[model samples]
Target: MAEPTTRPRDAALGSGPGRVLLTVYLIFAVAAGARALVQIATKFGEAPLAYLLSAVAALVYIAATVGLAVGGARGRVIALTGCSIEMVGVLVVGTLTVTDAAAFPDDTVWSRYGSGYGYVPLVLPLIGLWWLWHNRPRDRA
Candidate 1:
């Protein structure tokens, strides 16, 4: 086998549009994490479900941000999983909060399709997925 070159074979994941995605994920990670922490610390008893969901959302955002920053095939897979879960979480949580606000009793980052966050949470995953796909490595001719 030929010696491998140190130069990057593919573009860095965080290059170009991925940078924007990474920034968004970072913002979400911090925002959601802080919110979850405060809610859990200040009033867990009042809305355990919502607060727990908030923590989960924060974790997902953190994972996604890290994955995107890491780059490469493994990172893409990790980010893909995180984005998929985030999309589902937002949809399910958004619906639950909308259909029956009584159960949640509080808002999470995903509440109302991320209405609190200007619906960016609702749309971020889709954008992330597209960015991943757009940047997927292809066989060199």
Candidate 2:
């Protein structure tokens, strides 16, 4: 009979600190998606770019949450990509909104580096990337 392989301490991404990270991602997914939906439904013309960006942010958050919850090689890839995209999005959008407010004309979740949400939008991806690295898969040969 083959011996059972041991699971690493950091094997499960949804365990320990990962739970908190997952919760935050879920919350942001809901908040950004809902806000974007409402804005698009009522007054998309008011700030189409901002609303669309918020929707995109929400999708990224949702993907990250799912990746964390799933917790495997595939999950790691998904989470990594999502976090990378989110980090870039926040930086680009935040810079644009600050350097030229007229370009945005409205706030997305990442506006001013997420000043509206206490900058969680700005920092969450960094934390997520770290968490993903911490929980990376190990070879158990």
Q: TM-score of predicted model 2?
A: 0.91
Error of 2 at 126 (Å): 0.6
How high is the lDDT of residue 25 in model 2?
Answer: 95
Model 2 deviation from native, Cα RMSD in Å: 2.5
- In the range 63-114, model 1's lDDT, one tens digit per residue, is 8998788877777888999999999999999999999999988899999999
Write down the TM-score of every candidate.
0.90, 0.91
Q: Over the full model, what C-alpha lDDT does candidate 1 score relative to the true structure?
A: 0.89
Candidate models: Cα lDDT each: 0.89, 0.89
